[model samples]
Target: MILLKCFMVIFVGQFLDVTSVYNPMLTYNIRFNKLRFLPNVTGNYTIFQQKDKQYVSGYIQRPTTDEVNKYQLPVFHRCNPEGLNCEYFQSWTLTDLCTLLKDKNQIWSKWYGAFDPPILCPINQYTYVFRNSTGEVNIFLKWYPDVLNYQWKITQKLYSGDFYIGSYYNPMLTYVVRIVKITSYPNITWNYSVDTYKGKYYVNGNTSITTDKLIDKVVGVFERCAPEGINCEYFQSWTLTDICPKLLDKNQIWSSWYGRSFDPPVVCPINKIHYQIRNGTFDLDPIIKIYTDATNYYWKLTQKMYAGNTLVGSYKIETVFLGLSRIDDEGGVVSTDPSGLAYSPERSRL
Candidate 1:
């Protein structure tokens, strides 16, 4: 029994010696959302393996390239002049390889080709590569329920012996991991519609006026909201118009307004009276008041902009005489400003 026990111990010792190799020391620098423009994005990561389970831990940090390079491991480049790409492989010690292979669901796996056997190189599902001003850096990232986690490991391999019996020896390097929560911007869209009107009115005793004009006007309020129906920014501006058409001989120019929020509203008159009123001339267009209230996700167009409200500007129309007839009972040329502010009965002025 003692001799048998001795033989078993010797066999086990030989097996362990052949399986275990020295692992090198490497450095790893990891970060999350490094390409984002937001502020206060600083995080770090640490990984620990206990039997079949892996534990990851870290804090956030916004480190610069120089700062991250402090933890970077040195790499020996063996570039092929003909090939424009560089390939990287993880160097693992015999002990680390045995430990990693023990986990059937290891995060890293080997690559396989169509006619070739699986290569000894390692790759992870969450691993990625990005290039900055300096060079390329390997990144391992994964999206959790509400946050993003990042990680990467660096190692070096040393080859010894013949191609058949010789083995690639790897030394342990640096491993980094980090978690961060990313804040996203909201998606927004704005729409609007306009309605036109026309009418006729008496200018000065038997001098009939027709409204068929076009006035460039913008009359509306601004609204904004978030995706989850929270945290919204809303505001409204003044609505200015040249003049109003008479009640009779009026037609609604609806279903014709279509434009983005930044575009000005197009006001087309329905009749000559409406057109003449707005086209004649005006000093200051009348301003309308606007009001808005906070709600879930809807914005209601309340009142128009009036005095004491946010006054953006006034709408004005230049004098445009289309050779239309103007008859006055007073035998004098008749002209009226669209703002209804002034009227002149002078032949020369008309």
Candidate 2:
């Protein structure tokens, strides 16, 4: 039977930041139990080949005092010359180390060293102080075989610039970063704002204005990072002009137009008269009125003439010639013939 076992250790601290040091030595040692192989009575044995490539992968979570106390171990793995023990070592700058630490959660508690607290050193000086603290600083060191292929899953979206603001200076616009589905890591949504006024450009606020004066011409770069600040993927570089239009509010109103003659005239035989303004235009306004008499039904169409805002005259249609004839209340027979004289229909009534 093959057996596997894993052990974890934790250290706590308060703060962790980058230092100016170029390259600092770091090391970690891991030990494994002796291996055993079954012996065969009679057979040809083949030797297995192994590669020397190595890699380290692990994640740190925010550590609490109770968890640290429960997980702490007394004996530390020591380097051995016999090759039974594995020792991993590397040299890293303060900035590089800080970047790695930022990817971990509760970073200060899981990896800080009790004997060697990280210190800032002068650029010209090679020597730096490494002192022990109760739980003030932190660093992480570990190693494993390359086959482990360690990866860190992003839990939260990280943002750096002003993605949204109430006001903006002339020629500088605010923008935002949006990340869609990520194939490398599933179920992670990254969205944040990048504000120009916050001076996020080049990690400094100062930027010279270019000749382009159009508010839409301004552009800003946005990034999405896994683990907050390390190993980020460039999501989008958007301009304020492009995004502002989408944020504007829109209002629209729609009106219905009614009134066209039916194939068969509608019969209105009731005592109540009904009137409807069907079509109203600059040139023509048509009003339809329907009523009933004791003996016969009657339908009337009227048009009020207007020259600009001044009312010139009003005309009523004769039922015998609905479209061709019109009778004016003040000026009878308003419809004219080709000779420009008023023409009246033979049966012009009601």
Candidate 3:
């Protein structure tokens, strides 16, 4: 089965321009509600392969705790000889990875460099803090072959200057190594030091830090960067979760472009709940947000909502526009509507 699958992947590799597909191996969009701005995030590479004498691609997302164990997919752990045992990689060949990215136009030269790093595996974690010849900064992290035991799994975090922070699980190692990307030089430089034992995680080469203190610093950074009124909270490195408390807050004044206008409501079949929002263009924003919930499936009737000229809330309904299909090759979708019009509602918050 493995060999046959490999042949299929390699065969498909020949005909398909993976780069032309414009699919980043792993893409993440980060947003801060407080900022009143769109999300800004980049892709990361995890598995780089060579096929047909060309590079192919593979990548993984840094999943939350729940994502680590729920799926039946093959899991990777530190116990795995090469670090991560990724099964999805079966679809990609090496030639698919090395194709150069087309978008090289950076706003500044300091930001110019490889958009995605050349991935060479066998490690638990991979990170990049790129400072181009001009000194623009972009940070990225990738973890593959899921770490089975989050406890003993060690990762590294690099920052500006010669700073390296190790997510080391073994306290006894005593010698902690930090890799720093020198702004003056693109190459990584390393330093080793003893443990001072302070925060949940230590500063680059700072031995004495605990995770709690590390989290505190991250929260501080987020608060400073996030826009006002949006509640910013630490979610992970390079990302924060912002709660629009005011959007649902009772005490705050509500200000929508059309707050006084009537809201159209749509009925969701799965939960038997009605979704309501302002009419027209304002309706589009919330619908896209709900449709993009790839995990918790849902849908909306874009056609009916538009035809009825009703102000519909962001309710999940039977909609064909949101890519719900009757025969999904990649099973596990919660859709049950035979007509493919109905969508499974997200877990009801109410």
Q: How much lDDT does each candidate structure score?
A: 0.21, 0.20, 0.20
* Best-fitting candidate, scored by lDDT: 1
Per-prediction TM-score to the true structure, in the order listed: 0.16, 0.14, 0.18
Cα-based lDDT at residue 214, candidate 1: 34
Candidate 2 residue lDDT tens string, 1-350: 11111122211011112211112242222212211111111111111222321112222122111111111111222222221122222212122333444344432333233212231121122222222211111132223332111111101111112121111011000111111111111211112121221111101111111221122222434343432234545544443333233323121000111112111211222111122322211111111000001001111223232223433333322111111123455534444222221232121111
Worst 10 residues of 3 by lDDT: 1-10
The list of candidate 1 runs beyond 4 A from truth reads 1-216, 228-233, 236-267, 270-350
Q: For model 1, how does the per-residue alpha-carbon lDDT over 1-350 read when each residue is reduced to its tens digit?
A: 00000001001000111111112242222121112111223223344444422223333223221111111121212112211121332222333333443443332321011112222233211222211111111212121111111121122222222111111111111101000111111111111111111212111111112212333343644444332323545555445454233112122111111111112222234122211112121111011001001111222222221223333233211111111123355533243222221222222111
**TM-score: model 2 vs. ground truth:** 0.14
Candidate 3 scores a C-alpha RMSD against the true structure in Å of 25.0
What is candidate 3's lDDT per residue for 62-159, written digit by digit as tens?
A: 22211111111111112222212212221111121112222343212222243134222222233333211121112211222222111121111212
Output the TM-score of candidate 1. 0.16
Best candidate (score: TM-score): 3
